[model samples]
Target: MNSTGKESRHVNIHIASPVEEVYSYASDPANLPEWALGLGGSIENVDGQWVAESSSMGRVVVTFSPENDLGVLDHDVTLPSGETVHNPVRVIADGAGSDVVFTLRRRPGMSDSDFRRDADMVAADLARLKALTEPGQGPR
Candidate 1:
């Protein structure tokens, strides 16, 4: 999602995988770089919360947990200037998979660069998880 306060971007994707499996992977701090490599443009997370402190894109941390079957990520992230923002990212199981919706709320004066990057990364992560959860087929 991208926004300038008056307007923002909203990106949504539906992943074809069990909610539990996706949640497990998405919730794990270790798997972040695997899907969202540009989060820090190379600077890795070394914080106790597994947040990136040296990356130009700042740290994107996890704060919400799916309801075992329905994943909701209500995350709080800090900006470069010590400002905090809210991310209401929700993943709901649909049929044999799950649908994700992520919303980023901030004042209008902020740039959407990070929001766009974060949304794209999240979508990629879901895609990777979908591949991992596919049955009768192995990860390639």
Candidate 2:
């Protein structure tokens, strides 16, 4: 929680890879399902939109930020209810590796349990990303 009255948590993981490599992998919408299990089991580019068909929240559309050198992997997920949730993510250089950070915000009227669950899911997703981007993971 901050001065904005919105409760939030920063869930992050240190990946054993360079910022460019990690950002390149994470920024690609096609590679999302391999790491972002919280989003869905699979995703496809429907026309120009990225749709997650098997998402727990039902079919949702994901819009990602344009690729840049700053390592920003932010995205917006549009729920079935027509509400769009902005997810802020970043990959920062950390020595020879990189730290991937996700800012998880609690929506209004959400229960404490639900917020915690979302945080856990984000942490798990980061872990999976770390595994995939690590040195021995090869080219994912």
Best by lDDT: 2
Across 1-140, the per-residue lDDT of candidate 2 in tens digits comes to 32342887999999889999999989999898899999999999899999997547999999999999999999999999999999999999999999999999989878788888899999999998998999886556
User: Which residue runs of candidate 2 sit more than 4 Å off their true CA positions?
Assistant: 1-5, 137-139
TM-score of each: 0.65, 0.93
Deviation in angstroms for 127 in model 2? Answer: 0.4
| Model 1 lDDT per residue over 1-140, tens place | 33446554565666777767666666665665555454433323455544654355455553334335448655566666766666676767889977767664546555567556556765665565556555543452
Could you tell me how far off, in angstroms, the CA of residue 68 lies in candidate 1 after the best superposition? 5.9
TM-score leader:
2
Clash pairs for candidate 2? none
Against the reference, the lDDT scores of all candidates come to: 0.58, 0.90
